[model samples]
Structure formats: C-alpha cells, structure tokens
Target: MPTPDFIRDLRRHVGTAELWIPAVRAVVVRRRADGRVLPSPEVLLVRRSDDGAWTVTAGILEPGEDPADGAIREVQEETALTACPVRVAGVFAHGPVEYTNGDRCRYLDTVFEMETLDGEPRVNDDESIDVGWFPVTALPESLAEDQRMVIGWALDAGAPAQFTEPGTSHTEAAGEPAAQHD
Candidate 1:
C-alpha cells in the first residue's frame, strides 16, 4: 500500500484533472447599440483585475446558487451594470486548463444576452480593474479570443435565439459545425 504522503501527492495531481469535475458558471452578454430595450450607443465590457483581460461579465456559480442568479450577480459585481436576463445564447464546456489562479478548474460557460437597465457600468475594483461602454465595432483591443468568439456568436445568431452547443459561439460563421473545445 502507498504511504499517506503518496496518497496526498496522487490527489494533488488528479485533483486538477478534468475528472475532478469542477463546477463552472455562466457568462453573460449585453447589447448596447440599437437595442430593443435600451436605445443606446454603447455596450458594456469588463477589464479583469488580473491579466487585464477585457471581456464580457462572467463568473463561477457558487454552491446551490441558481445559474441565472450567478450570471446576474457576477456581471453586476464585475461591471456594476443592471441587466435583465433575455435568453440563453449557448453553453460551452471549456477552460479545464488554466485560470487567474495557477490551480485549474473546468468551465461550463453559458452565453446570455442580458438587457441593461440603467447607469453605465463602472469597474468594481475588487473583481475588475476597469469597466466601460464601447461600440460593438470598436471594442477594446484587450478582449480575449474566447470573448471574440462569444461576441461573434451573439452577433451571428442574433441573441434571443437559443444555443446549447459549444459552437453556439460561431455556428453560423463556421458553415459546418464549429470546432468543439471540450
């Protein structure tokens, strides 16, 4: 039989494995320009406190927290933007590799099109460094590739349409099935 230390080491290694099955949360998106809800010219984006990664508001779901509630809370906490849940854009099994923390956790990213209520978003320094509005065509350059894909999917699928696949982020553009990440 292995020693306790051996078991500890084994767990440390396997704990990070996808088999570990970490819980993931949904990501939310909002339309600004020419929106049915808010006739505006700006869209919200968040600048992560770490890595300065600018992207749509998102976060991990807490134990027993409703997925929709988590998305609303995260976006509000990260961007301070009041938004109404519109529809599910898609779901993706992603990010089992890396994160702001060195420790890895898998992500089940649910893309949503939320409607902004009032007050432009300002970054909540605890979770994000900066938050502001931008035109869809002139989004900040710091957006991650994944964000680009999500935004692309939202634009292509015309938010409000339901998507449940990982490629819901790019199915229309792919012509065929969009490449699955997980």
Candidate 2:
C-alpha cells in the first residue's frame, strides 16, 4: 500500500518515537440464508501492494476522526465500495513494526462488520494491487490470522463488539464463545 503523504510526513517528524496510532478495519459481508441469518461465505479482501498479503480493508485513523467514519472511508478508499458499518466487531492493538524508513509505531485497530451499500470493489488506490470478494472458508494462506479471527467474529450474527487483549487467543473474549463447527 502506498503510504499517505500525511503519514510519511508524520514519520519524518516522529523519527523513532513509539507512537500508538488509531486504525480501523472493515469486514464487509453479505448474508446468504436458508431459513436464518447466515452470512455469506464471501467477504471482501484486498491484496496489499506493499507485502502482497490478502487482508480486509483497513487504514490509520486521522486525527480527530471518528472510528466509524474512518472505517467507512478506508473501505471506499481501499476497495472503492461504499460501506455501512452494522456494528463494531473487535478492537485490538497490533504493532511495534519498525518501518524500513526508521519509524516505529503501533496501531489500536477497531474492526467493524459492514454491509456494502454501493459500488463493486476495484483497486481504488495504490494501497491495494487487487480487490475482490473471497470465500471466508478458503481465505488465502497469506492472510493474517488476526484478520481472519475478526472476520469470523463479524460473520457470527448478533455478536457483540469485542475488545481483544493483545497476544491472547481470539477464542477467549469478553462474551459467550463463538459457535463451534463440528
């Protein structure tokens, strides 16, 4: 993904300081039901140009930006799809990556379950090399496990928003356990 100019400028100013930035991720899904609310197996995924990893739409939150609005904006900017966030799925802190440019940072990411309101996904920006809907069951191996966990939670109907402690297993959260598959 192309680094936004604001971030590049911020990196220059911050130098090596360990800053905690706010970020957001959108898990855009559709429901395919037989007799109940069953989320479709497919969710939108983007291939990051930077690492070639397939993941959900996400970006850093700008100063004073609301997380919900940021989530919507990131989805449009990254995937060219209009998103209506149904609810927050998870909040997490991931970080300590030292950029090759010598800047260090961590992101407190809020993940949202969203429905696509309009527009089909295409590469809207250089952040993603490609964008498409993919089956959640057969997600690319390159996708991050944490991202997969968030998607799983988002697909579970009526799930409450979650705050996942960093480094803990996703199966252990602040509510009833997710449905088991047998």
Q: Which candidate is the best by lDDT?
A: 2
**What shift in Å separates residue 122 of candidate 2 from its native position after superposition?**
0.7
Tens-digit per-residue lDDT, 32-131, candidate 2 = 4343655547789888887777788888877789999998999998888898999999887665556666666667778899988888789988777899
lDDT at position 146, candidate 1: 63
Estimate the TM-score of every prediction: 0.66, 0.82
- Model 1 residue 42 distance off true place after TM-score fit, in angstroms: 3.7
Candidate 1 residue 57 Cα shift, in angstroms, is 0.5
Model 1: per-residue Cα lDDT over 144-177, one tens digit each: 5566666655555455544445443233333333
Which pairs, if any, clash in model 1? none
| Candidate 1 CA-lDDT value | 0.55
The Cα error of candidate 2 at residue 130, in Å, is: 1.0
Provide the lDDT at 179 for model 1: 20
